[model samples]
Target: MTRTPQSARTTTRGIPRILAAGLIVVIAAIAAALGYQSQNASSSSAPSPPSPIAPRSERPGSLGAGGAVPDGVTVFDDGYPAVANLDPDLLRALRAAATDAADDGVKFYVNSGWRSPERQNQLLREAVSKYGSEEEAARWVATADTSPHVSGDAIDIGRSNATAWLSEHGAEYGLCQIYRNEPWHYELRTNAIDHDCPHMYADPTQDPRMRQ
Candidate 1:
């Protein structure tokens, strides 16, 4: 065999080094791609945060049923709706009476109870608007100052069953209907628990208290 040239031998040795450098670059590129893939996979699998919700008690302008009354606000108890701002004696008596009535399958509900002067006046104004005159409105709504509702001394029950029950059993609890036409209206008659309820007024017109 002829002796190889020195330059050719040198060039032949350089070829292995070039191939080794290329192999190293290829391995580094593969490792970098695998690292990126692993990071992306880990980030995509993490959990998202939960969304929030509000309860009914958080609503504005009105307190929820079954909740404690807020500060400076006179609202009803869990069992009584539309009954607020009442005399403590009256409310206590009414609740006691309602508890008894419930035992006999009569659940007493209040359709109307105490009202602020503004509320009473607004009602009277609306009534006058509906009836076309104060005289006609007096047949239904009373002046704010004279209205028992503004005084927290009156309550209005709904449902004929409850009213009928009150007609029969209310005297025992001192809740007596005070008007013939307004059979739903009742006032605490302390004497009723001992004797009998006072005779009902024929109407608001005839009630002597209305004149005052």
Candidate 2:
């Protein structure tokens, strides 16, 4: 198309305003993205303990761990891998206990289990960012070196009944709660089957095992 001198001049003059409007839009989009992220972080603040367990009639299928991963179960959704990345013995014991719990109308579900060192560190950093300090974060997330999650030996059970049932009967299964503050965190303590579970640490800071 032929450009008239008058038309070319007008086009050139409008370029600055178009560039300015585009810059404004880009800045606004960035602001909106950041705001959405901040709101999501605030809303997803670490999950607090859930409510007490509600009793239900005994159900089958979830009964034995020897079978395939059950329906309605997925790694991120239910936190149970086809095989938990936990310590072999510990994972075996957990499955056995979960099978038993299923017979009693409780379904044992994993909330957190077997974290990679990188994942553990990321969680710690996030916790610190959320809690405002490392000390405060330590109360919840543990260091990668000391975290049983990183070692693939700890399991955090979900569902109140699973935890509650374990609270009362876990000794039989050799699953013991580790932290008083984290009732969901359980570890395989074969000795606990005969002896009572050890005195619980009030939090990570009190646990000598967590020494940095």
Candidate 3:
């Protein structure tokens, strides 16, 4: 048998060590890349923090015993005391008017109707604050004792279109706009159905009914 050369044997053995070292380097590089990718994915999937600004909550006692009239209440919504507690004659006239108004693509939304005395007083106070004095406030909000809303004899309609419709045709149903400045304000005046509405007061301050 021929003797093998030491240098050739040594070189053959070093080939496996070189390949093993390169394989180890490749495995280490792959592991590092996988780790980096996993970190990026974890951060991307994280949830966001809560919002800083919150919605305003309703104040205590903002709504009085009668409760406030909701935004979309119509004359026919008896579920609300604002509509149901109105004077019988006035409610009847409003319902009749609302029925007819619907045919013209109009809706009689009750912006304000019956209010408790407490609610009226609160409104008066708010008005006084807004207008800077009781005298000026009186032009807009009446005293709780004298306010027709407390007695369910008054209603404040809403949306310009509804008021326009009422201005043209309210007299037919005995629903007359009482104040020139407040075309939205209305009351039942049965005579209006025949003789047309009486002269409108400049504002609530000029109406004798507000004095009481």
Best model number under lDDT: 3
Ranking by TM-score: 3, 1, 2
Give the poorly placed runs of model 3, Cα more than 4 Å off: 1-67
Using TM-score, give the best candidate's number: 3
Deviation in Å, model 2, residue 186 alpha carbon: 0.1
Instruction: List clashing residue pairs in candidate 3.
Output: none
Give the per-residue Cα lDDT of candidate 3 at 153: 93
Task: Write model 3 residue lDDT over 1-212, tens digit each, in one string.
Answer: 99779999999999999999999999999999999999999999988777675433343223324747878878887777788889999999998888888999999998999999989999999999999999999988999899989999999999999999999999999999988888899999999999999999988899888776
Model 3 score (lDDT): 0.88
Q: Which 10 residues in a row give candidate 1 its minimum summed lDDT?
A: 66-75
After superposing candidate 1, which stretches have Cα over 4 Å from the reference?
1-82
Please give the distance, in angstroms, between residue 80's alpha carbon in candidate 2 and its true position after superposition.
6.2
TM-score of 1: 0.67
RMSD of 3: 6.4
Question: Which pairs of residues clash in candidate 2, taking residues 3 or more apart in a chain or in different chains?
Answer: none
RMSD of each: 6.7, 21.4, 6.4
> Taking the tens digit of each residue's C-alpha lDDT, what string does model 1 give over 62-176?
4523222333232234333335567777888788877777788877666677767777788889999999998878877888878888788887777788899889988988889
Candidate 1, residue 193: how far the Cα is off, in Å: 1.2
Model 2: worst 10 consecutive residues (lDDT sum): 58-67
